[model samples]
Target: MAVFKEIFSHCSDLVYRKIEIEGRQAYVIYLDGLIKTEDLQNHVIDEVLARKQVGQLSVEKVEEEIVTVSAVKDQSYLEDAANDILEGNAVLTIDGHNKGIVFSIPGYKTRGVSEPDSEAAIRGPREGFIESLRVNTSLVRRKIKTTNLKIESMKIGVQTQTNIGIAYIDGIVDKNVLKELKHRLDRIDIDGILETGYIEELIEDNSWSIFPQIQITERPDTAAANLLEGRVAIFVDGTPFVMILPSTFWQQFQASEDYYDRVYIAIFLRVLRLMFVAVALMLPAFYVAVTTYHQEMIPTNLLLSVAAARESIPFPAIVEAFIMELSFEALREAGVRLPKTIGQAVSILGALVIGTAAVEAGIVSAPMVIIVSLTGIASFTIPKFSLAIAIRLLRFPLMILASIFGLFGIVVGMVILLIHLCKLRSFGVPYFEPVAPLRFSELKDVFIRTPIWMQNSRPDDFVKENKKRQANDLKPSPNKNEG
Candidate 1:
C-alpha cells in the first residue's frame, strides 16, 4: 500500500479501500470514477466479507473463491498492478501476500456506437466503431465470426501507453506485408500517440507524399471488407477511425455503399467518382491553360464570350484562378471549423455571394467562377476525405505549372505525378496497384466494380497466399422452365 501510494502520489483520483478477508487485513485499490462502485461493493467487498474461513487468506484462494468478478488477473509485481489500476482495473492486496489481484471492472464513460457522420451511407450497416479499442475489436469480430480472424494487440506510446490492435485473417494475410507492418510498428518509438494519424505518419512508406498511404474509415464494414481483402486494420484506443493498410489508389474512391447497391449502380457511381476525381484535379489547370495560351482549343462562340467576360477583368487567367481557388478553400475550411447548423449554409451562401460579387465587381470573370464552382463540387465526389485533401493540395501545383507552360505544363505535371505514384509503395504493396503495375485480373474492381459474383479472387498483390476469394461459376442463370 505504501509503494502504491508512492507510485500514485499526488493523484486525487486514486482510491484505496481497506477490507478484511477471513479476518486478515486487505486493501482494494482503484481509481475513482474509473470503476463501478456498485459492482465493487457487491462483487469484491461483499464476496470478501462473506468468506468465513478460519485461517489467513492466500491470493490464489481469494481470487478463485471470493471474487465474483468475471475477469480477474494475478500480478506479483507492484508495477503491473499499478499499470492495471491506471487502465481502470481494481487491484486487491493483502497484508502478507506478495501478489496482487487485478479485477477487470472498467466503467469509464464512452460515446455509444452510432452512425458515423463522415462516412454516412444509404445502403450499408449503420453501426460504426467507437473510441474504445475492445468495443471496436468486438464490432469487427461480430462481422467476421470465424476463428481465422485474428486481432493481435500491443501497447504503443511510452507515456500514454495507448493500446493498438493489428487485425487480419490468419490465412488470407500476406506474411511479408504483415511482417513489414509489424516491423514498422515495432520501430515506432514515440512518447505518445493521441490518434491513429500519429502512427500513420510514422509508419507510412513515404512521409513526404501528400497521398494517404493508409486508408482511414469510421465504418466497421469498410474495415472488415479491407481485412477480407488481406489488408490489415490498425485500431487505436481513443479514436473511432481505424487505419486500413496497404491502401491502393483505387480503394479511396470506393464507398461502403458501393458493395451494398446493385452491380450496375455501383459501376456507374464508381465511374462517376473517377471522372469527377479527374475533373477536380485538372479542371482549374485546364481552364487556365486554355484561356491563357491554348485559345484555339475553345470554340469561337465560347472563346468570344470568355473574352468579353474577361475584358472588364484586370487580372490574367492564372491570377484570377488563384484568387477564386484560395477563396473557395478558405470558405471550405471555415465551413468545416464552424458549427454544423451554419457551416453548410455558410459555405454555400458564401461561395454564391462571393462568386457573384467578384464577377460583378470584375475581380474575376464569369467563366472562371463557373470553372471554380464545378471544381469544388467535383472535389466533394471523392469518397475518402484524405484523398480529397491530396487532390486539393495538388490542385495549386498543377495550376502553377499550367500558368507557366500552358497545356504543356499541365501534361508535364501529370507525367511527374504519375511517376511519383508509380514509385510510391504502401507496406511493400504498390500504392497505384492494378493500373501502374497493370494487373488485369485485379482490374475488375479498380476502374469499375464488377458484380460481387464475378470478383472471385482477391487482389493478387496483397493476398498472394489466399488469392481465391470465392468459388468459380457464381454468376446467376435463369431457369429454363420458369416461363
Candidate 2:
C-alpha cells in the first residue's frame, strides 16, 4: 500500500480499499476516474462481502468464480499490477501474498461509433472506428471473422504506456513485412504516441517526404480489405484512425466506395480521380504560366476576357494566383476547425463571398478566382486526405516554378516530382509500384476497375507467395442453352 502510494505520488483519486478476505487482510486498488464504480461495487466489493461465510475459500473463490469479468489474471510483479491498476483495472492484493489478481473493467465514456466525417461513404456501411482500441480491434475482427486473422498487441510509450496493436493474417501476411514491422516498432524509443500519426512518423519509409508512404483510414471495411490484400494495419489506442502499411502511390487514390460501387462506375470514378489529382496539382501553375507567358495556348476570345479581367488588378498573374490560393487554403483550414454544423456553410459562403468581394475590389482577377476554385474542387475529388494534403503542398512549389520559368518550369517540377516518387519506397516496396516498374499484369485495378473475376491476383510487388488472390477463369460466361 505504501509502495503503491509512492508510485502514484499519493494521488487522491488512487483508490485503495482494505478489507477482510478469507479472514486474511486484503485490499482492492484502482483509479477513481478510470473505473466503473457500479461494476466495482457489484462485481468485486459486494461479491466479496457476500461470500464472507466462505471463510478460507474467499481468495480461491475470488480468483476462480466471484468477479464476473471477461479478463482476470494473477499478476506477480508490483510494477505489472500497478500498470494494470492505472489502466482502469482493479487489483486485489492479499496482505501476506505478493501476488494479486488484476481485472479488466475499463469504463470511461467514449464517443459512439458513427459515420466518419472525413471519409464519408455513400453506399457502404456507415460505421467508423471509435477512440477505444478494443472497440476498433473488435470492428476489424468482425469484418475478417477468421481464426487466421491475428492481432498482436504491445505497449509503446514509456510514460504514456499506450497500447498498440499490429493486425495481420496468419498465413496471408508477408513474413518479411511482419518481421520488418515488428523490428521498426521495437526500435521506436519514443516517450509517447498520442495518435497513430506518431507511430506512422516513426515507422514509415520517409518522414520528410510529402507523399504519405502509409495510408490512414477510419473505416474498418477499408482496413479489412487491405489486410486481405496481404498488408499490415497498426491500430493506436486513443485515435479513431488506423494506419495501413506498405501503401503505394496508387493506393492513396483508391477508396472503399470503389469496391462498393458497380465496376464501370468505379472505373469511371477512378479515372476522374486520377485526372483531378493532376488538375489539383498543376491547374494554378498552368493558369499562371499561360496568362503570363503563353497567351497563344488559350483561345483568342478567352485570352481577351482574361486580359480584360486582370487589367484593373495591380498584382501580376503569379501574385494574383498566390493570393487567391492562400486565401482558399485559409478558408479551408477555418472550415475544418470550426464546429461541424456551421463548417460547410462557412466554407462555401466564405469562398463565394470572399471571391466576389476580391474581384469587385480589384484585388485579384476573376480568372484567378475561377482557377483557384477549380483547383480546390479537384483536390476534394481525392479520396485520401493525407494524399490530398500532399498534393496541396506541392501546388505552391509548382506555382513558383511556373512563375519563374513558365511551361518549362512546370515540366521540370513534374519531372522532379515523378523522379522522387519513383525513387521512394515503402518498406522496400516501390512507392510507385506496378506503374513505375511496369507490371502490366497487376494493372487491373489501377486507373480502372476490371470486373472482380478478372482481378484474380494481388499486385506482384506486394506479396511473395500469395500472388494469386483468386482462381483463374472466374469471369462469368453465358450458358449454351441461353445462347
Candidate 3:
C-alpha cells in the first residue's frame, strides 16, 4: 500500500492533508474533489476538534458521536482506510491508532437528472444517469428496493482506481453468468477506465467483432429492467452509459418504453424496428447491386427511368453511389459533433442542398439519392445509436462488394456477416440469440414483443438457472357471460 502511494505521489489529483488536534496529530486524507469540503469541515473535523471534554475522546466514544461515520462495529484497517479515500470516502486517522473512520460524503459535482438523450421516451421517467456513480446507483436502487438487489463493488484500473459495480438480483441471476462477468472484469489490468466503454472493450467476448456484445444505456430504468430480468449491469464511475452484460442481437433493437406502452403497439413497433434494421443494413448494398450489375431485376420501365436519370452522370453507378453515401455520412458526422440545437437542421439542410447540387452537377444519379435517404431513415429506427453506427459502417463495405460483383457479392457479404454473428458471444452467451439457437418460446420477446402476459419467462440466453419471468397462465380473458 505504501509503495502504491509512493508511485502516485506525483499525481496532481491525489490529496492528503495532515491535521493535528489537541497535540495529537492525525492525517485527514481523501482524493481531491471526490469528497465534499463542507461535510469534512462541519461533520468530521468540527465534531472531532470541538470535543471539549478530554476524558471522553476514547476510540469507542469517537466512533459513537461522529454522525457521518459509516462503520463502527467493524475494525478499520489501513488498507480499508486507503480504499475508502480512493472511493471518494474521506478518512481521518488518529496519530497513534492504526484504524480510522470513513465518512461517506462523496462531493463530486455531476449533471442533474435529465431525459436520456439516446433512449428517450414520450412517456415514463425522464431521468437519465449522471457522472457520479453513487447517485446513479441510488437512482437504480430507488426503483428496485429488493434485498436481492446485490451490488458487488470492485475497484479496477490500478492507476485510476475507478469504482465499478456489478449489480443484479442475487437469487435470480445465474451463478455461472455472475462468475464469468467477475472473472472477465478481474482480468482487465488497464492503466485507467474512465468510461464503461473501456471495460466493455476489455471484457467483451469478441474484441475484434464490429457488433457490440454488451448493451450500454444512459437510462437507469433500462439498467434496472435488465437487473430484474436476471442480467448483470456494469457501472463505471464517470460514464453516463451503464453496460448490461450477455447482450443478444435482439436486445439492441429493444427500447425501454416497449414495456410501458400497449403490448400490441409494442409488438408492432418492435417488428417495425427489426424491419428497419434489415433495411438500414442491406438497402444500400442491394441498391448498388441492382443498379450496377442486376439491371434485369428492375422492371423495364424502372430501368429506363434509372438510365435516363443516370444519362447526365459521368461517374459509373458504383462511383455515384459512393459519392452520395460518403457525403451523407460526412453530413451525419458533422451534425452529431455540432450542438444539438442546430445539429438536426444542419444535417437535414446539408443533405438536401448537397444531394440537389450533386444531382444537378451529374456527380450522382437520382435513384442513388432515394436509396441513401431511405437507408439513413432506416438506420435512425435503431434504438441503440452505437448499433445504428455499426450498421452505417457495414453499409460501405456491402456497397463496395455490390459494386464489384453485384447481387452475388451482397449475398456473400450477408453470409459472411451471419457467420461472424454466430461466432460472437457476450460473456460466453451466443450473440445471435433466439434466431441462431432457435429458442422458439423466447422469440416472442425478440423479433416482436409478445403481450406482457405471454412473455412468461426472461431471456434464457443470459440466465439459464432462472428462466421463468412470471407464470404460464397470465392471459387476461373477458367474461363472455357477463358481457
Candidate 4:
C-alpha cells in the first residue's frame, strides 16, 4: 500500500494528514482542492477523532456511528488511499493496518455557467454547458426529465483518468449503435483526454477521412434534440463540445436555429445555406475550370470583361486565382490569430489593399480576385467549422482537376466526394441521409425544413420505435370563420 505513494511521491495535490482518532493513530488523505475541507473536517475528521463510543471501531461501525455517510467504505492502506486521492475521493486509514476506507466526497471549483458561444441563438436559452462532467450531465437531465434518459459513465486515459459519459434514450436508441459506441470507447487507451476531439478521433470509423461523421456541439439544446431523436451524445469531462453519433453528411448543413424558427424562414435560410455550401465548395474550382479550359462556356459580355481584366496580367488565370485564394486564406488566418480589438480591421484592410494592388499591378486579374473573395465569404456561411474546412481543402484538389480537364474535372471531383459520403457511416447509420436513401418524409429537415406542424415525425432512418413527434391533428392556422 505504501509503495504507490512512494512511487507518486504523494504529489502536491494529494493531501496526506496524520491524526489520532479516539487515541488510535489514523490518517486522512485526499486531493487537496478537490475535496471540500469543510466536509472532511466536520463530517469526517472531527467526528471520528471526537467520538466517545469505544468498542473496536470496525470499518462498518465507524461509517455507521462516526462518519454516518452513504459513500463511506473500507480501502486498503496507502495504495487504496493513493488511488482514491487521485480520483478526487477522500480516504481514511487507522494505525497499525495495511488498509483504509475510501469516502466519496468530491468538490472542485469550476467556471460559472455561461452562454455557448459557438451555438449561440438570438432567441433561446443563453446557458451553456460548462467543463464539469457532473454539471453537464445534470443540464442534459434537466432537459430530458425522464428516467429513460440513461447516462453511462466510464474512465478513459490511463494517466488522465478522465471521466466520459455516453447518454441516450434507452428504448428509443438502437442497441447496435450503443454497443458499437461502447466498444470503440473501451478500445481507447491514451495518456489523457483533454478535449472531446481526443475521444472523437479514437472512436471514428475512418481516421483518414476529413469529413466528420459525428456531430460535435456546445449547445445543450442541440444535444437534447439529438437525444430525443434516438441519437447518442458523448460528454467528455473537460470539453464543452459534446459529440453526437450517426451524423449524416446533410446534417452538417442543418443548425439548431432551424428548429427554433418558423417553417418558411427556416426553409428559406436552409436553402440559402445549401446554395452557399455549393458555392463555397465549387466556386474557386469552377473559376479555374472556365478561365483555363472552358472560356467559351462563359457569357459573351462576362468573357469580354474577364479578358479586359486579364489584358495586363502577367500570370495565367490559374496562377492568378491561386495567388488571390492564398492571400484570402492568409488574411482569414491572421484575423483568427489576432486580438479581437484589431483583428477585423487588419483582415479587412489587408484584403482590400492586397486585392486592389494585385489587380492594378497586373499580378492577378480583377475578376479572379472577386471570385476568390466570394468563395471565402461563402465558406463562412457553413455553421460547422469542420465542414467548412472540408470544403476548403477539397477546393485545391478540385482546382488541380479544373486546370487539367475543365468541367470534366469538377464532375469527377464531385463524384468521388459523393461516393465517399455514400460509403461513410456514423456508428452504422448512413452518413448521407434522406438524399441517398430517398426518404421523402425526412426531406422536411434536410434540404428545406418543413413546417413545424408538418414535421410530425422524427427522421425515419433513426428512431423506428417512436416515429411520431406530435399528433397530425394539431395545426397552427384555422379557417376564416373560426378566426
* lDDT ranking, high to low: 1, 2, 4, 3
TM-score of candidate 2 to 2 decimals: 0.97
Stretches of candidate 4 exceeding 4 Å from the true structure: 1-4, 52-58, 68-81, 96-99, 477-483
TM-score-sorted candidate list, best first: 1, 2, 4, 3
Q: Which residue pairs of candidate 1 clash?
A: none
The better candidate by lDDT, 1 or 2, is 1
Candidate 4 clashing pairs? 75-100, 75-101, 77-99, 77-100
Q: Give residue 441's error in model 4 in angstroms.
A: 2.0
What are the per-residue Cα lDDT tens digits for candidate 2 across 69-174? 6678898888998889878899988776668888887888899999998899789999999999999999999999999999999999999999999999877788
Candidate 2, 475: how far from true, in Å? 2.0
Candidate 2 clashing pairs, residues 3+ apart or interchain: none
User: Candidate 3: worst 10 consecutive residues by lDDT?
Assistant: 66-75
lDDT of 1 by residue, 7-57 (tens): 999999998899865557889999999899899999988888777773536
Cα lDDT of candidate 1 equals 0.91
Off by over 4 Å in 2: 21-23, 53-58, 478-483
Cα deviation at 364, candidate 3, in Å, is 1.1
Per-prediction TM-score to the true structure, in the order listed: 0.97, 0.97, 0.91, 0.92
Report how far off residue 415 is in candidate 4 (Å): 1.5
- Any runs in candidate 3 off by more than 4 Å, and if so which? 1-22, 30-32, 66-83, 479-483
Give the whole-model CA lDDT for all candidates, comma-separated. Answer: 0.91, 0.89, 0.83, 0.83
- lDDT by residue for model 3 (102-146), tens: 678878877898988788898689999998887899999999998
